[model samples]
Target: MLIGDVARRSGVSARMLRHYESLGLVRPTGRSEAGYREYSSEDIRRIFHIESLRSLGLSLREVGLALDDPGFTPSGLVDDLIRQTRERIAAETELLTRLRRIDAAEPAGWEDVLRTVALLQALGSESAGKRQRAALSSAEEGPVPVEALAEAALSETDPNVAGALRWALARSGDTGLPLLAEGLGSPVAEVRRRAVQSIAEIPGGAATALLRQALTNSDVVVRRSAALALGTRGVANAVPTLIDMIVEGANDVDAADALSALASDPASTDQIATGLVGRLARGDVEASARRRLTQALADIPGTTTSRALADLSNDDDRAVALTATYLLTLRGAQ
Candidate 1:
């Protein structure tokens, strides 16, 4: 076949076919009557091969090596190609995400678009301080999409940056709650904790509801953060987790404070007191845990807590007896 016919038939442009020949990738096996380049069946086949390899993100050099070098092994090259393809896809996906967030911001003009883009770039900056500043400034300029803020809040490791991101998300509104809630289900324990903590900062019935739901999360950290937030919100459902926190001595002081807040509700006072008493009766409750539980009851105003405190005041552990006695004295004075 003539070069023109091969170019037309194989869908390889004439210029590319010529470039392949210049690089010695595919040589014309013969010459036509007009002395033009002629492509034999094998030459045309080679052209098709080069085109096929290029489609997989192979450079022309790699394609040439893949086809001509009998000693070349495809396994290494193929693995490299796979890695390159994944990287390209990840870059494209990140760009798409940035575009979607920019669109969500609803920029009205070029200046708005530029500002939104600058804020997004800053949020993704390698420096935690820059990212934190971006988060703090996000609200002053205007709301970045809550989705962007939620994603940052969930993945951020720097305490200061994460706090700023959570604050920005809270101000952006509960629209980010659904996105943040999804993070609560993440397989990463740190991510789940951050998600629940961020949700806790968001004020609203929806955020409170999410925290109440998170009280039952399998991750202990998630459950504790949710319980603390709910306790402050006066949600009584977090009582069990709050009590567990006291027993475990993980932020037990904060846990005790949350229980006290929950106790302010007349209906939950007995339930909270009774729950505390149940743990105290357990043989498994260590002396330290027992003391923590006893100290937790000081803020409960109900008769159930009073009776439990009275029983604790007579306990064998000297520290427990003293702590309980002091609490009872304070209660009596109140």
Candidate 2:
């Protein structure tokens, strides 16, 4: 076949064929009588081989090595190609994410677009200070997309930066709740904990609903955080988890205060007092937990709580009995 025929049949343009020849990647096995380049069947096959290697992301130089170097092994080269492909894909994905966040910001002009881009870059910066400043400036600079704030809040590791991200999300209201809800399902325990913590700071019935869902999350930290937030919101469902926190001594003081806050509601007072007393009555109640439970009862006012406290005043554990007696005295004086 002549150069034109080879270019037509193989789809490798004549110019590319010449370039391949210059790189020593392919050479015609014959020359026409008229002096034009002519390719034999074997030359056509070699052209196909070069195109195939190039399809696998091999550079012309690598393709030359692959075809000419007897010692050239494809294993290392193939692995390297795979690594490079992955890096390219990661860069593309990051770029796409940035574009999406910028689009979601609905920038009014090039200035808004530039500010949003700068904030996003800072959010991902290696310096914690930059990240925190970005989080703080997000709302001030005209509201970085809520999605960006939610993503930052989920991944932020630095305590101060994380706090700022949470504050930004809270100010954004429940707009970020769905992203945070997805974060609650993350396999990483820390991510789940952060998701619940961020959601807790958002005030709304929607945030409350998400917190209620988080109460049943498989992660204990997530569940604990959700319970504390729910308690502050005056949701009665947190009562059980609050009681559990008291028993296990996990944030027991905060849990107790939450219980006390819940008790301020006339309807929940008896229920709160009863839950605490039931834990105290359990056969497995330890001395410390029982005392914490007794101390927890100090603020609960009701016949149920008073009767329980009076019964606890004569308990066998001296500390428990003293705590109960002290609480009862305070109650009587009231």
Measured against the true structure, the TM-scores of the candidates, in listed sequence, are 0.92, 0.97
The 10-residue segment of model 1 with minimum total lDDT is 142-151
60, model 2: CA deviation in Å?
Answer: 0.6
Per-residue lDDT over 113-198 for candidate 2, one digit per residue giving the tens place of the 0 to 100 score: 99998898898889999999989878888846899899889998999999999999998878899999999999999889889999
**Largest TM-score belongs to which candidate?**
2
Total backbone collisions, model 1: 0
Candidate 1: deviation at residue 36, Å? 3.3
| CA lDDT, every model vs. true structure | 0.90, 0.92
What 10-residue stretch in candidate 2 is worst by lDDT? 136-145
* Pairs of residues clashing in candidate 2: none
Question: In model 2, which regions exceed 4 Å deviation?
Answer: none
